[model samples]
Structures are given as C-alpha cells and as structure tokens.
Target: MDNPMKSSFWMLCILIDLWPYVEDNLTQLQCNLFSIGPGEYFRSLVAQQKTHLWTQRNLCDSPNDAHDRYISNHLFAQLVDRHCIDDRGPIKLFCDDFRPQNIIVDPTTLGIKAVLDLEFTTAMPSQFASEPPWWLSLAGPDSYLVRGLTLDHFVEAYMYEPRLDQFLAAMEQAEKTHPAAEHHKPLSRLMRESWRSKRFWFNYAARKPFDIDDIFNDCLKDGNASIESLDEETRAGLDAFVEAKMKQLKAYDTDCARHLESAG
Candidate 1:
C-alpha cells in the first residue's frame, strides 16, 4: 500500500476494467439520455473549445504565439477531418478532474475502493484517451514548465518510476483480454509516439484550456518542419482562420470591458 508504483499500476488496471464497460454502453446511454451522434458531438465540442481559447487573452501572448495559434488551429482542423471520416472507435469516457484526491483507496491493499466525482465524467473522441492521463503528475502540465522542467523531462521521470515495466505488461495483458483488443492496441502505440513526438501536449491541450498556450508552443517547436512542409494553400487558410478568430476574440473582450466600465 505504501508503494507508489503498485498503487499506480492498480489504478491503471481499474481504468482498463472500466473502459470496455464505458465503450459498450456509450451508445445506449447516449440514446437514452441524449440523441446527438458522436460526430456532431465532437465537432461541437471542438468548436466550443476553440471559441473559449480564442477569448482568453493571456493564452496567446508568447513570442511564437502567432505561429503557435496557427499550428494549433490547423492541427485541430486536421484532427476534426480525420475523426469525421472514420469516427468508428469507442469514445473515451473519463473524469476531467481525475486526481488522487478524488480516489478512495485502501491503505492496506492499495486498491481503489471508490471513485468519488462523477460529475465531470463524460465521453470524448477515442483519440483523446490515446495518451496517458495527466493526473500522473498530480498537477497541470504548466506547473512543470514553471518549475523549469519540460514535458519530456516529466515523462522521462514518470517512466523511470519503479515497476513501470510491470504496469505496462499488465496493461498489455488487459488489452489482449478485451473483446476489442485490435481497436485498443493503437492507443498503446499512440501513447508512446505521443511522448516521443511531443504530441502528448496536443492531446493534453485538447482537454485543458489553460494549457493550450504552452502545449501549442511545444508543438510548434517539435513539429516546425512538418508545419513548414504543409502546402501553401493550407498554410494560408490556417493563417487567415487564426487571424479572424483572434480579431473576433479581441473585439468581444473589448466590448465586455466597455460594458463593465459603463456599468461602473
């Protein structure tokens, strides 16, 4: 129970056990409670997130902010297109605030007895679940940056933890036993690639609004060559879209400030 590695592995196993149930029942639950299809849901969610980020002033103030915004919007559009074309996998069901504080664990056995918060739990695109959970750090990704540690450094430290190999082995065995093992196998691979390519930041950013600026900056640094390789028309479109969005956001913020001033 005192062993952190054992505790983490057990938590991972719990997640593995819960995933299939969530995936299998998602459609039925959606039908019973709401009627929107997953594709439409994804589009709406992405659009809303984009709008929310656009309106936040401090998120895009870095030196490479323009390029970062351009890359983020373009990558998001591509992600949307890809998911729209083949939105066949099971949607990810996760709690937004998945942290140790919310988990009730047995001190003697290091087993999770109950998960407390169900309010923030929801389904998202399977790709969102492809990467490792952010809760591993017990803090937001920005906290690492504030401590002068890169995301890669954080990941490296996590990987070096004891019994990580055993944890991964258990995960692999669990995946093999699942009915949709083939579909789930890609997530394991994607998780590794995400870490290596710094794409984990993008996945992280997708879920957390405040982390977008830092993630976007990291992505731009890591994928600069790939971004540059994009076709001229595509790049131009991305530039125009981001420019317009920024203008709209600034106007909205200004209007809000003026209204507050008048009221005051």
Candidate 2:
C-alpha cells in the first residue's frame, strides 16, 4: 500500500480495462482469455455460494426473535438469489466494511494516507460495487434508532435526499474525470437510478443477513411480506417451524445461562 503504483488509484484501474468488455459479447470473450469468467457464470456461482451460506445459518445466529429470523433467512435468501439471474455480473471486489474511519488521512494536507481493512473485501455482484455506499458517516437507514424507522418508514425517515443530491453532484463531476468511467455509464447516474429503482435496497439487504428481516420489509419488499402475510407457498408449515425453533432457542439460552453461572 505504500508503493505509489500499488495505491487505490491503480487498484481501480482494473475497471478501465474491464468496462468496454462488460456489455459487448465479443469483448467479453477476449476477457475470458485473461481468465475473467463471463458475467453469467460468475453471477450464478456467487448466488449458489450465498444460498448455501444462508442455509447454514439460522435462529442460532440471531437469537432475539429466533423463529422470525430462521424463516426470514430462508425466504429472503430466495429473493436475494434471484438478483443473480441477470447478465449484470462479472463481479467486482467490494468491501461491506467500507466507511470513513477506515481511511486514514493527513489532516494538515487533507490527503488520504492509506486505505486500511482489506479483510472484508470480496468479489460481489456488480451492483453492490456501483450502488452508492451506504456508510456515508451518518446513521444509515438500516441503523436508524427512531421508532417505526426500522420498518417500511426507513428511507423516508432517514431524510436522505438532500445529502444524496449533494453527493451525486460531486460524484458526477468526479466520474467525468475518472478514466475508467468513460466507457461505462456515469456512476452518479447509475447510483441515482439504483436508489430510485430500489436496487440499492436489494444490494444492501442481500449482504446484511442479521438485519434482513427489518431491511427487506422496510426497503426491499413491495407490500406486506411479514410472516402473517407471506404467500401460501412460504407460509405453509411456518407456524409449526416457529414452534419448533422457539424450543431450540430456549435450550440455547438455558445453556448460556448455565455456563455463565459456572464461570462465576
């Protein structure tokens, strides 16, 4: 990271070579020669991996509402997987932990020092990379503490538009100068459209499984998708599943309490 040629600027230069190829079948074939898999294959592979990971976790991962967490994970994982059916891939490296504090800066000169925390980086769906970052040094809609804000009132309650407009204007200016952005649509335009189309919500909810139930219903869902209003297909046997799941969590909680007592 200290090397001038190995900075974030050069890391992003990979896109300059990739954009002209993403939408052109002939160019994509040329890219495959360099070991960049086609968009469709990469998307499908990531989707399968995500689905398997989702199934492996359940109420145990989130104990607050075990039954709801277990069911929502399965149901929403289906919707999240559907996002992968498109040709919009050749995945891009993304970092969910990207935020202000992670980027160290020289306060006197107002220059970035180094980008830390590369551990969270992964090859993710293209949209996840293009959509505007959710961590804008503010309480994102997902982490809002106001009553009712965590429900469908999320986006509206965040009071996001004024800041978003300012960010987009700056982004539009930056995109005009970025070499990689020339072949692709302006990232600012894509981000505004991503927000408008709610693809941003899908991309966000797809990553945060612990908060998926609230985020999916509040932002991603079209209408009532709660356990009570789920379609018959997803609703079937849910009642019994909830009952069995609650029992498991009860045992889990009891074991934790017993261990705490022993430790004392």
Using lDDT as the measure, which candidate wins?
A: 2
- Runs in model 1 lying further than 4 Å from the true structure: 1-46, 57-59, 62-64, 79-86, 146-148, 157-166, 173-199, 219-264
Please give each candidate's TM-score: 0.56, 0.65
Query: Which lDDT tens digits does candidate 2 get at residues 1-264?
Result: 396534544344434333443345444445554554334444433343334333322234444465555455555655645554345456678888778778998999989999999899976657777787776536555566344455433445555666688888998788667834345677787788888877777677666544666776566665655666556765786655556556655665565556546645
Model 1 lDDT, residue 52, Cα: 47
Q: Tell me the lDDT of candidate 2.
A: 0.59
Q: What's model 2's TM-score?
A: 0.65
Residue 5, model 2: lDDT of 39
Compared with the true structure, what per-residue lDDT tens digits does model 1 show for residues 164-246? 34455666677676635443454556655555555555556666655555565565343444576566886777656557556
- Looking at candidate 1, the ten consecutive residues that score lowest on lDDT are 159-168
